[model samples]
Target: MVNISEKDIQLLQEQVISLHKEAVEGNAKAVKDLHQLLERVRSDHSDIPLLDAYHGSTMILIARDKTNPLDKLRWSKSGLKLLDGAVSSAPQNIMVRLLRGKAAYKLPEKHFHRARTAIEDYTFLIKRQIHGEGFLNTKRYWQLIYELGEVYHRIGRNQDASICWLKLKNEAQDPSFLHLLQLKLKLLEGKPSVEYIPDAESPISNLIRRAANATESELNNRLKQQKK
Candidate 1:
């Protein structure tokens, strides 16, 4: 590991802060600035663990918003190459693969396997939490999970999509919300939410409501007859 002086790190910190602001604001200029920061990181603090991660994530964003997906792929590969060269130096480097897989997935749907692998790596990294940086903030694991699921769905893989949604659905941890989400998915896929009511908003939801109301009244009538 290359040692960087505190003074140099402090200098880099200021630039990184400004670059972060630019990133949040969606400034077109931020991409160039982030590239410049990565260059500085490589030059000044070659083995610092955080630098490659930050660079990898920024490169993923660049790949995501590029006017041409093909051109973005080249930049994405370049970022990954940089990470690959130093991956041994930064042994627990989930961000690099995660970013690369996300880029590859964007470039082509056939690359879903790559995205899946990246997600797996990230999950392990999150569990480890090797650094103080909270893994959830550092990575978009859930978003990628959803995206991967959607990609599978696009390829007519309902079963695979269901796999992802079931995990996501279970994560909600509320039975009511879980049922709502399940019902929503049923609506999305043009399936029935329940035996009596079809899945739909507005008119269909209303129809379901009316059906329930009628059933409630029927139960009340039965109760009244029994009471008599």
Candidate 2:
């Protein structure tokens, strides 16, 4: 067995994070690269909770490239299983929780029925963030709150959703983000009579996506350096 040093593992993890950002942004080639990188990591560092969680995330991303419905579902299920195992093994790992939470929320509830799981993970992270226990900076922290509210609305918990959104509205400093929050609140008002379904292409969703992209500046720079 080849012995991998801690520095090697850290670099691998950093590469994973960089690739994950591209994967999220709809880079198909990045998906393949991320999958290969994660496979290499798994071969070297079995049972590392962070690696498992990231590999699981890559599996879920790979599902998007599958042409067959059955294949997509199979990949998603397998990915989620790995994510669940990671969380169960390292419940205190906030990064694992956030990755699983995002995965659960992104999945369609009718098929995966992971809405509650998403809510649980987000809520757990939110509580920790409230206590300054997590690593999320201000923008990502409020972004998590926004995402949590969306999950709440998914499950018809309007009041809870409102609370989350309103809390962000009160403290968030970005003008554009605050404007979107106002628009979202208005949309939420009419949600009681209609089921709240999130549209990925919606303006608010795009804003959040942009915010996420902005937050990864450091990771993006590291990726560029790695390429050269």
The candidate that achieves the highest TM-score relative to the unseen native structure: 2
lDDT string, candidate 2, 1-228, tens digits: 578888988898899999999997779999999989888768877779999999898898887666655666778889999999999999989999999998887775545667789988988998898897858887778877887787677667788888888998999877877777787788778556335454422332233223332323443443333223
Worst 10 residues of 1 by lDDT: 193-202
Could you give candidate 1's per-residue lDDT for residues 1-228 as a string of tens digits?
468789977787677657855763457688778877787667766666557656765665565456554545555556556544545565566555454444444433332223344444444554554355565542244444555554445445466566766766866654654564475357447532222211211232232223232422453353233223
Return the top candidate by lDDT.
2
Worst 10 residues of 2 by lDDT: 207-216
Regions of candidate 2 where Cα sits further than 4 Å from its true position: 190-228
Clashes of each: 0, 0
Q: How accurate is candidate 1 locally (lDDT)?
A: 0.52
- Tell how far residue 228 is off in model 1, in angstroms: 52
User: CA lDDT of each candidate?
Assistant: 0.52, 0.77
